[model samples]
Target: MSFSRRAISLCAAVTLSYGVISPAIAQAQDFNGIVDSVHTHAADDASAKMAPLGSYASGQLAESAAEIVAFHAGSKRILTVNALSGEIDVLDASNPQKPTKIGSVSAGADKEINSVTVREDGLAVAAVQQSNKVLQGEALFFDAAADDLGAAELGRVTIGALPDNVHITDDGAYALVANEGEPSNELDAAGTAYVADPAGSVSVITLPAPGTVEAATQADVRTAGFEAFDAPGALHEDIRIFGPVNHHNKPSLDLEPEYVASAKGKAFVTLQENNAIAIIDIASARVEKVVPAHIADHLQVPIDSSNKDDKAELRTIPVKGLSMPDSIHAFTSGGKTYFATANEGDAREWGVEEKDGGSGVYTDEVELADVIDNGQVCEGVLDDVEAEALGDKKVAGNLKLSNVSGWDEEKQCFDELYAYGSRSFSIYDEAGNVVFDSGSDFEEITASLNQPGVFHHNADNEDPDFDDRSDNKGPEPEALTIGHIGERTYAFIGAERVGGIFVYDVTDPANAKYQTYINNRDFTVDFDEDNYDSTKLAGDLGPEGLAFIDKQDSPNGEYLLVVGNEVSGTTTIYEVESVVEKEPSTSGSTKGSSNLSRSSLSSR
Candidate 1:
């Protein structure tokens, strides 16, 4: 059902992107029962950014574990090689509850790593660490012995140190490793992952510049067109290509960042953190640009979020947000290109800094300016970006400000500059305009609120009133991701201060629902559904990574579900069978007299 103009205008406050209408958010709160009605959290969330044993080994965990295999299916049992655990679990979902645990292996000393791959021969190829930290060691190949369900001892071959990733050619006849492992800014840390083979062969790749070679690097030049390459260490035999990262001029962490993915005809790499996605041109050993977002070549990330209880010591550049971007992914759609980065909010928000860095100075100095019509460039822009637009109106002695992007559809740029309500999902178009907002749209949906509100962390419960223009403040999405399977699209959202994932269905693009297990017609399920009609299943946790492996159009032919665990340091895989669609017991009507409308909530 549609709303009258007056009813729809009431939602002017429910803007989709950047301050569409601040008054609406305030108005929702003023409604009382409506705001509190939404309260349902997802199930799994073991996240707590822990101080590492010697600094984190890697962020993007790729293990050949069972969960990984359930998501990526092939003739050979593939697993997401967990660098920390040094083991792989078999993700055979014949039985969902009891995922088989296949034998484990150990990443030799300081080799704490990030991603990994396994060859048809069961040889595990992983990206290990090589630096001052504990995981600093050479990328090695360990033969998997499934005897112990993953605790077996396997032989090893040292490939290269400070490694990034390891790759095996399709025929399995050749293997490659990318080693760009240099000490990260935070000592013990290295930005590079290497590609290597079991024969002790290795190749190092440097970070790619954001706009160094344009659109996307040529696939052939990604690895310099070499069938083979070697590390700097001892021998130089059959070195068909130059080193990926030369000692003297290694690319910055933000530039030419190395990451590998297999595409249709060839292997493509992403210069992550950088603005380009380089598809490897294996023949000539060069990389071609498949995507370029005009981002930093090597992301200039702040070293630490904290420097004691004082100010954070910031670096001299801006690769991402005013702070640092913790994670990133290479995403593409239609004919357009994009990259989704999870920028951990500013350090000051965390409330621990250095004296000189910021003594009582509130970085929350942001003021809401008049909403600009980004639909058309300058024609809609509001003047005075430096000053507030509420006409010198102080909101409880604080300046009034506009709401940030709820969901940008034009996603040409990274999702860092915008504001995604703490643990909210925002989808942008290739052009960077917000297209959907799961948070605002799913209003009243219990799963929508409690699931994603894991991060409404506000030291001060300062309320911002647009009607009166009060300063109601809260946290933003700690991290956000989109996953599409079949005709269904799901968003797994993470909260900053809180733990767990919020699942939202954006199949309709505008209105949506939270993935729920039980069919309930409650205020939290306000987006209609019919409100929990059992179209999809919902799970929870600090889901850092999400994948819909069972899409009909997918290359892999498996009905799978994969969720990355940021807290437990493990990727969970599930076989999501088709949902048995069913309507709830309630009729087509509003259970309570709340201002939230099904269409309005979903539309926003």
Candidate 2:
């Protein structure tokens, strides 16, 4: 129990209700003068609070995480990029729920590390790549006061080809990344080839402040007005690539850039398979307007499509699609400047299944007897050989879809089958428009908070039948961030196949609300009979990335959040505290009602 007495008995102490003041002038009111007589006492004590407070794991079962960044100069480190050990790790979160680890750096053999950035005075950056069919990449840097957790390189620079995410702006001045060109699986003989097409762009990194010498180059951001965002030609022949691969003097070049969020000075990014959003600026690194990101309208937007039975259902019908986002951020609230996305949809193809018969193909699929009839094709998204070779017609539509792919073809009916992730979480306006959207409200709030065969459960299971990712992307919200905690302004998001973390209240970006849902993912253990022992798990799996910090830049003085967990490599750390409601159990006297007590700040 002693982790500082379970972190001071789980926080508790935000009580204030002074009306009948007299007991010797309310005991001469001095607990630092009642915390300096409330100047809106920490946003009225951190409105709608939060809890969790503990978790760390870092690498046990197949270590897989991609984004996370935290700093606070003298102590609270964090970093974490490890996409299967390409490396960045460095924990020691100044103990926000026992973090430890202390080091990591690698990015050498098979290098994969996908994104990290620091700059709170410790200075850092990362993106490192190679295996996304090796178009090559690199950005790596860190000099947090002359390196300790193996962090001081600052020179690899290259860039472009699977960089997938990286940022670092708040006045440290530069660093962006997002090169996601992703393709690679070479085929041919009727299957097509070229997988690294046009090599997506957005690199930047000029960061020259704190104790200089960090030159860092790479800033192309591809232009010619992006040659009209091409993307299609059968999604470049099912991700096979007959197009851009580093812009062959520019013709079509599909914009891939998947995530980068820099604040006010601009940046934004997230082209996630060309469902667009570019913005840029940051002192003229370029690309000032790309926008595109539209297509929500599934009958006024409501969705939960795991294609029919990956259950947690939400539907809404008559479709349109592509809010296809993936990890986005940019915060500010009341003083405006929004941004939040996690639509989590993506596309492109390669192939395998004993060489070209499975997991590949260039997405041209269409056939429920060519669009509809055999009982309107929904067969739990068929595929036992397309539901035993089309018995009642199966393989529905795909043609590299999502430009609003709710297919109708004169009533053949793809009516609401939209596809590719607008499964929810939005809010834009930096010209990206749409100010609020949580439609299907994360599938009716994770099926009214779990337990009906545990909504969407699939971390290799401990019961609760997997349901194969609900046919395609339900609960796939995937990473977002934003914070303020008092005087409103929340956001969070992060679902990634229904694992957890939703918290909304967007301080009125046109009414945001939905305030709670956080998971740690132990779901009764057994990812194949335990031994993965993250203290018998039950939370934090697949969250992919989110960070908050704030209690004066937090070094654990409270108001944290953290999360990382790409399928349980783990990193939890919650503690947004702020509750005080007690006095409601008086009708009878047995004493079993429990209206919530525990003081300094803590709750489940």
Who wins the TM-score comparison? 1
- What would the TM-scores of all predictions be? 0.44, 0.31
What tens digits encode model 2's per-residue C-alpha lDDT throughout 314-398?
A: 4443334566788888877556787888887765555443454453355532333334334544444433554333222112221
lDDT of each: 0.31, 0.57
What is the C-alpha lDDT profile of model 1 across 407-457, one tens digit per residue?
A: 133742223222212113433333333344332222222212221112121
For model 2, what is the alpha-carbon lDDT of residue 389? 34
In candidate 1, stretches whose alpha carbon ends up further than 4 angstroms from where it belongs are: 1-94, 100-102, 119-123, 131-137, 142-145, 148-258, 266-268, 289-291, 294-540, 546-558, 569-571, 578-604
